[model samples]
Target: MFLGIDIGTSSVKAVVVDGTQRLIAAASTPLAVSRPHELWSEQHPDDWWAAVEGTVAELRAAAGRSWAAIGAVGLSGQMHGAVLIDGAGRPLRPAILHNDGRAFGEAEELNRRLPAIGQIAGVPAMPGFAAPKLLWLAHHEPEVLRQARHLLLPKDYVRLRMSGSLATDMSDASGALLLDCARRQWSPEIAAACGIDLSLLPPVLEGSAVAGELTAPVAAAWGLKPGTILATGAGDAAAGAIAAGAVNEGDAFISLGTAAQYFVARESYRPAPEHLVHSFCHGLPQRWFQMAALLNGAGALAWAAELLGKSDIGAMLAAAETAFTGPSPLMFLPYLTGERTPHNNAHARGVLFGLTPASGAEQVTQAVVEGVALALADCQAYVAETGALPEQIAVNGGGARSPFWMKILASALGKTLHVQEESGAGPAFGAARLARLALTGEDPAKVCTKPRIAAEIRPDPALADAYGGKLVQFRNLYRAVKPFYQ
Candidate 1:
């Protein structure tokens, strides 16, 4: 048996995969992020490890006796969250999450030094990336920065607790903004500008390489045999790509969890300078991906539910299903939290520009769905700049649960949404598949996605024409709101 784990912002999920990549058992436990105020999001590093122990205990209780000796393990987690450790391995303070945009002011200053950053990382500057988060810590929480000896991404901290070793995967490291991701090495220039020595970062390992072995303490606590290999895994989304079999050039996938990003796999490193899509190294060797995050998907729905409807999420979807949208001019700007791709603005807020008192919850719900689609379309436009339209787009994350939203997305982007073969298992499944890959040395490229032909929502020509006009208006709304935000 091989084990795979994914540490998310709000949860830790574990899965056990047999040699054939068949999932034997899976479990998840939630972890809380303490955001004391607006412009802050933080989590204790210990909170993640506690959940790992809890989940591993559940895994052992369920599958410990029957399985053969564990051969390997792989790990994936949410990216860009900063975890600081002292020389004795004690954490200094809470981790600053990728979603925390307090560094927007810091990002502007960093952008002025963009020529050097672009040459190294092949991507534009963003506050959500790790380096800025660290810079913010240095400025605001210098006591923590002063006491810190090593810094790791959230998942790496979990891995340290599991195997007593320090490591990070290239895919996750790429998001740190401290790496020359294109060259698969640390960028000396970025480190200098941020006043950070590259030594503060963990060693980069490829997706399938052995990161470390489970130590005696972890082995006994988790009831695992000693010396089990732990394979260096990837970021949650990259691991999800491997699990969904979206691993090669031109293959595309989308995840609509707390946040949404359109992931497109590519063979070489390339940044879209014109469209502002994010470029990063992929989990597979010699592979890369371009991602455009919408910043709101399920989050927008949750807010709408809290404000307009009750707290029931299913009710929002059900209401959206009956609601009228095709004939209306109501527009939803999904920038409830600022946007990353295309606009890259942090101050932008959500706007309901065409709302009338006559509008009901369904129309509001439809606008939320359409707003997500338009943001997705912006990503499609970015990839079009590379002269390739995604042939089959695979859907994952919470948005995949809503058929109504899927229909709008399909019609909006004019692409068939191929639902994955399994229920969305998130990135834990990715870790399991990669763990299986390491043990058997199987070729990942051959494990292509055979997604089921779920009910296809063909593009409504009339609705498409209407949305085309509305998209222009949608873009205009953001522009009109730009001054207020600035």
Candidate 2:
């Protein structure tokens, strides 16, 4: 048995899988993000540790005797979070998350100072990247910077507690804006430019390599044997791609979780900074992928459901589906936490336009779903420009379970979407497979086969035509409101 853990924006999930790649058991613990200040998102590292422990305990309880058979562990987590640690491995403060937009000024300053930053890092210097968060701390919270001795991404910090080692995998490190991504290592020059010492960063390792053995205390606490291998895992999106069998050229998947991502695997590196598309190393060796990310995804749907006074999102979606005969006059911009793809604007905020007295819960809810679909359509346009379009895209995440949203997305993008039997189990399953590779020395291609398809969603000609018109209006609305946000 292998163990896989994912530290996500709103929860911590763990899964147990056998050698045949079948899931044995799984558990998740809920988490909350604190927005103490406007445009800021933070989570306490201690809360993450507690959630990880709690979820692992739940998994152990479910696995029973099979728990002791676990031989290796793997981790996957939200990317680009900044976790500052003191000399003794204590958190200096709450970790700033990827959706936080407080560092917009710092991102611009870095881009102004380092002209080749996008080329070096394989991504634009955006506020969500870790380097800008560090710079923001240096300027506004100097005391925290003064005492900080190390920086780790969300999963690496968890790994540190498990194995008493400070290290990160190349896939997670790529999002930090401190890595020479093409070379798969930290760039001393970029670190120096950010006024950060290279020593503050953890050592980078391959995603499938052994990071360390579990410490005896943690092993005993989790009811695992001592000296179990801990594989260097990946960021959540890359792991999801692995689980979807998107490891080859032109293979792609769209994720609709806390954040939305359109990922396409590539055989070689192809940087498209001008389009704000992310080029990063893949979880496996000698591979890469291009990603277009939006900060708001299923989270926007949740917000709309609460605002409409519905306790259940599924019911809200059903209402929206019943009301979806044609496009509504109401339109929404799903930029609740700013945006990443195509436009690198961090000051942008959500907007609801064309509201009338006739507008009600169903119209507003459908608008929210359509709005997200339009934003992803914009992202898909840019990804298509890179000539990495897939024959069919795998769709997964919390939102993927909604038939209404999947139909909307398929029509908006005009492509077929494969819904797997294990639709939302991508990241945890991928991490477990990576653990299996590390423990058994098996080929990744053989280990990460695509799951069986439960169903396929295709575009409706009429709905696609309607969305095509709505797409133009959506772009115009953003252009009209861009200056107000600035």
Candidate 3:
């Protein structure tokens, strides 16, 4: 058995799988994000550790006899989070998350200082990236920078606690903007521009490589065998791509989690920064992917659900399905946390138009869902410019559970959407597969096979036609509102 742990924005998920890739046991523990001020998202590193402990304990109780057979632990997590650690491996402050937009000025400054940053990093220096976050701290909290000895991404920080090692995988490290993405290593030039020391970064490794053995103390406390191997896992999106079998050229998947991503796998590095597409290293060696990410995705739906006094997302989606029929006259701009992909506007904010006295909760809810679909469609259009459009897209994440949303997404993109039986498993399952590869020395292609397709959503011509028109309106709305954001 292999174990996979995914430290996500909202939860910590752990799963155990057998050699054949069947899930044996799974568990998750909820996590909370703190918004101490507007445009900032932070999480306590201790809370992540506690959540991981709870999740592992749950998995242990559920796995029973299978627990002892587990040979390796793999990790997957949210990318680009900046976790500052002192020499003793202690967190200096709350980790700044990828969704945080507090470093806009720093991002601009870094890009200005290094004009070749986009070419070097394979993506523009954006506020949510690790390099910009560090630059922000250097200017605003110099003392913290002075005391910091190392920088680790979210999952790597957890790995440090579990294995007493400071290491990260190329897939996760690629998003830091300090990496020479083409060379698949750290770039001293970029680091110098950001005023960061190369030594502060962790050693980069392949996703399937053994990072460290689980320390005896952590193993003993968790009722597990000592010296269990731990694989250097990947960032959430890359892991999710593996789970969906998007490891070859032309393979793609749409991730609708806290953030949305249109990910396309490639055999070689292909940078398209002009379209704001993110090109980064794949979890597997010698592979890369072009991705267009949006800051808001299912999280936007959650926000709308809360505003409508609904507690359950599934129920809210059902209500939205029955509440409206065609394209919503009420258009929503899902820039709640600003946006990435095609438009790197950090100042953008959510906007709702065409409100009427007769409009009710249902109209607002449907519009929110449609708005997200439209934004993702924009991402699809940008990715298509770089290569042939994907024939089909594997849909996963929280939004994939909703048949209504799946139907809407298919119609919006005018492409068939394949829903895997293990769609909800997301990155955790992929991490488990990576663990299997590490433990068995099997080929990643063989170990990370795609799951069975439980269902498929095909676009309806009528709905597609309507969405096509609404898409034009969506673009125009953004253009009209662009000036105000600046």
lDDT of 3 by residue, 33-147 (tens): 9999988999999999999999999999999999999999999999999999999999999999998999999999998999888888888899999999988998899998999
What is each predicted model's overall lDDT from 0 to 1?
A: 0.78, 0.90, 0.90
Candidate 1, residue 70: CA error in Å?
Answer: 4.3
Off by over 4 Å in 1: 58-70, 324-329, 447-457
What's the TM-score of every candidate structure?
Answer: 0.93, 0.98, 0.98
Q: Over the stretch 151-249, how does candidate 1's per-residue lDDT look in tens digits?
A: 899889988887888988888888887878778988888887787888888899888777888898888777777887888889987887877677778
Off by over 4 Å in 3: none
Question: How does candidate 1 fare on TM-score?
Answer: 0.93
Q: lDDT at 338 for candidate 2?
A: 90
Measured over all alpha carbons after superposition, the RMSD of each candidate to the real structure, in angstroms, is 2.3, 1.1, 1.0
Query: Model 2, 1-486: lDDT tens per residue?
Result: 999998999899889998877788999999999999988999999999999999998999998888999999999999999999999999999999999999999999899888788888888799999999989999999999999989999998999999998888888999888988889899987898799889999989888999998999999999889999999999998988888888998899998888999999998888888889999999999899899989999999988988989999999989888877888789999999899897888888899999889999999999999999999998999999877596589988888999889999999999999987676776877788889888998888898888888779999899999999999999999999999997
